[model samples]
Target: MMRLELNLLIEGLHDFEKAKRLGSLSNEYCRESATIYLSQEDSSILGVSDGDIVEVSSKHGSVKVRARVRSDVRRGLAFMPPSPYSMALLGLDEHPSIIKVTVSKSSGEPTSLTTLFTS
Candidate 1:
């Protein structure tokens, strides 16, 4: 059931050709890299440091990524480098977004890297 819902969500996002066109592609269909920013308050709360691993989760799903803590400060805010991995967990739309991520102290399993690529 969850897989079905996820597929539908992905399909809906893929319907927006213009948005997809705006996305940068490295292999014609995949995004290579993106810039992500974080707020100071969130960084403090999560205790995220440069090269720290952050596990972001939402009602729909969850993802883990390497975090690069920034100097800028804003409470309850964070960002993720745009890629298929982030997109899968974050969904495609900007407004009425699907997911809210959380930064944490726990180190996620190393095997999790495969999921990032598979997305």
Candidate 2:
């Protein structure tokens, strides 16, 4: 399998994320948090399409999330919402917002919030 290592930037609160913040347990928030935005070229290189499950691993650990292919993202960088899921990958990095991670297509289900911190 092809795996690409790139910088994963944890974006600040998005509008929808802020709106859903009150309902942290809402499915919408979870879905949004469990998504990773990848460049179209990167997605194609990994043989993954939008909504496909992908495993993103950092020195801290690995998490499976849905891939959102977007042309806005750069070829060697990925974007993710600031959530527990993103926190898990960051571990204790000083610059939590930006970290290196390995991304690859996966057939596994997205990691759940409950299991995110536990693992």
Evaluated with lDDT, which candidate comes out highest? 2
**Residue-wise lDDT of candidate 2 within 1-119, one digit each (tens)?**
99999899898547446746668788888888888999999999999999999999999888899999998889999998888878888766459789999999998789988898677
TM-score of each: 0.53, 0.91
**Which pairs of residues collide in candidate 2?**
none
List where candidate 1 sits over 4 angstroms from the true fold.
1-36, 91-99, 108-113, 117-119
* Model 1 residue 69 distance off true place after TM-score fit, in angstroms: 1.2
Instruction: Tell me how candidate 1 scores on lDDT.
Output: 0.45
Clashes in predicted model 1: 2
lDDT score for residue 71 of model 1: 65
The superposed Cα distance between candidate 1 and the true structure at residue 92, in angstroms, equals: 7.2
Best by TM-score: 2
Deviation (Å) of 59 in candidate 2: 0.5
Model 1 per-residue lDDT at 70:
60
Model 2 residue 36 lDDT score: 92
Give me the overall lDDT of model 2.
0.87
